[model samples]
Target: MDYHLYPLGDQGVLIELGEDINLKVHERVKSVSAHLEKMNWDWVIEYVPAFASVAIHYDPMKVMEKEGDSSLYAYEIVCAYVEKELEKITPSHSEAPRTVEIPVCYGGEFGPDLAYVAESNDISEEKVIDLHVGGDYLVYMIGFAPGFPYIGGMPEEIATPRRKEPRLQISAGSVGIAGKQTGVYPIETPGGWQLIGQTPKALFRPENEIPSLLQAGDKINFKPITREEFDAYKEEEK
Candidate 1:
């Protein structure tokens, strides 16, 4: 219930709901964001919600114009309104998270770090795949790469830390794990997470109405597929 509001340069206001990254904090973050989006306040230009905070971008000129008392600053006006509004917002739990299934071809050439991950965990490659697929992860936020999801809910049994050395280039659709999190690489980019599999589905497409396949508050499940099936899925996309 405790929160803090801070200004970001001249255009953005960041709301910190809690100090730690947890489900309860995210719930508060999402609630505030949902309320902000609905209000569509004249000064608010955009909303960027993360695990424990939400950044609200606004027009400084518009905010200043609306405040009749020139003595009141832009950030002050925004902070007051946000604090008052948030006090009345009751977090909604009616909505069930949308689940998306991703098909992955594990090990071999597709996942260069698969062996390392298995050995590090003292588990067989098949067991590693099982643990990865068994998770029902929640999409906490999207960043790092376009449509790159930072997901949570991986079992502790399979938790693996990030690689000491990052790869110069990782292929799109590559699935990787770091610490207690798992995510898919939306595009070819340098990364340090341990690669476990690759998915054929495009996580980000500029032409699509919804450019990012995943969104915050959604859930994901990994499905293990054969190497041949992976090839077929890739071909079908063409």
Candidate 2:
């Protein structure tokens, strides 16, 4: 219930639920986001949820029209409306979070930086994979690229820093470890995360009702698969 509201540019409001990135903060962010969605205000354009905050974009003209008072600024009207509605929201009453399983093909051609991660952690390549798969990961937020999940709860034993020089092109489905966090590249893009594996699953599906395969607050489980199995999975998708 504790939060702060700030103007995001001219037409948006940034709601700060908490200062840190933790389960409690994440819950509050999700709660506020859900509450806003249910409100369905005509002035609200869209709301984007992040680790500890939610950015809401609104239509200034619609807000002014709804208020029926041109004397007052649009941003002020929106802020007052948001403040009143947010007072009714709490971290409780949220629906159960969804769990997603990501199958990864580690090492070899798929993961060119597997050896580097193993060496960086002073562990064997197989141990790195074992620790990664054993982790209980959570999708905190989606950013950088569409459908790309910024995951948390990676095991400390296998943690590794990003590459010294980012690759020009990283194939879609490439799983990588950056610092203590682990994530999968949803689309073909350049990044510096330490490559460890590749998933056959498509994280970005533009044709679907929901384009992102993963969303914030979803639980993640990494499953290691063989090269043949990866190929078979990809074949099924076609």
Candidate 3:
């Protein structure tokens, strides 16, 4: 992965950390985040982490006045910071990320595509749910939509391709996957991921201040529950 710095005007810099998304790319995000937090750059306002890059925000007007009109200058400063940190890559093994249990109702109406997924994998639908809930999924990043978490650890057997034709509107909490990544939508919106099942938990609640229930670096687990339980939880909330 060639890490090239892209200077955005005077205040913003984008670091191309990698070309692929994986556990290693995820590590880069964490490394960049940890480095920026320590530098406390006077010009940097925020560091937004994506799957393979970090976008550093800054005060454009202030930077322009002090550093002149060259975007390359800003790029160099940010590049140096990122490169220095990358070079001193002392592995700080994060604790098996904090796991959050999520209850899900599988098959029937709840998991409409269960049979399809099972058929595709030459396994029973019950086995599908078992494999899904069996292991903890790592939250790699949040993108595509707010509170929409990108997770890893989906069993390869049940891994299905996204629908050729996406639904016009998918309900919030719809758990879906595109290629190898599985994620849960926070709101009803257009998407192309293969729909699997849904969760009752509110992934995003605006009134909660920090609306997103999950954050990058968190671990997740699915607990298959009954339809009755799903309805009861929803009713209880109402």
Q: Highest TM-score among the candidates is held by which one?
A: 2
Q: Note the Cα lDDT for every prediction shown.
A: 0.88, 0.91, 0.78
Q: Is candidate 2 or candidate 3 better by TM-score?
A: 2
> What are the C-alpha RMSDs, in order, of all predicted structures?
1.5, 1.1, 3.0
Stronger candidate by lDDT (1 vs 2)? 2
lDDT of 1: 0.88
Model 2 lDDT tens row, 1-238: 7888998999999999888989999888888898889999999999999999999999998988877856779988888888998889867834887999999999999999999999988999999999999998889899889998989899999888888899999999999999999999989999999898999999999999999999998999899999999999999999
Residue-pair clashes per prediction, in order, are 0, 0, 0
* Residue runs of model 2 more than 4 Å from their true location after superposition: none
On residues 63-88, what C-alpha lDDT tens digit does candidate 1 reach at each position? 99889676888888888888889889
- What residue pairs are clashing in model 2? none
TM-score of predicted model 3? 0.84
Tell me the spans in candidate 1 whose CA falls farther than 4 Å from its real position: 68-70
Please give, for residues 115-196, the per-residue lDDT of candidate 3 as tens digits.
8778877999888788888755998888778898989888787888878888898888877767666788899999887677
lDDT of 2: 0.91
Evaluate model 3: give its lDDT: 0.78
Per-model TM-score on C-alpha atoms: 0.94, 0.97, 0.84
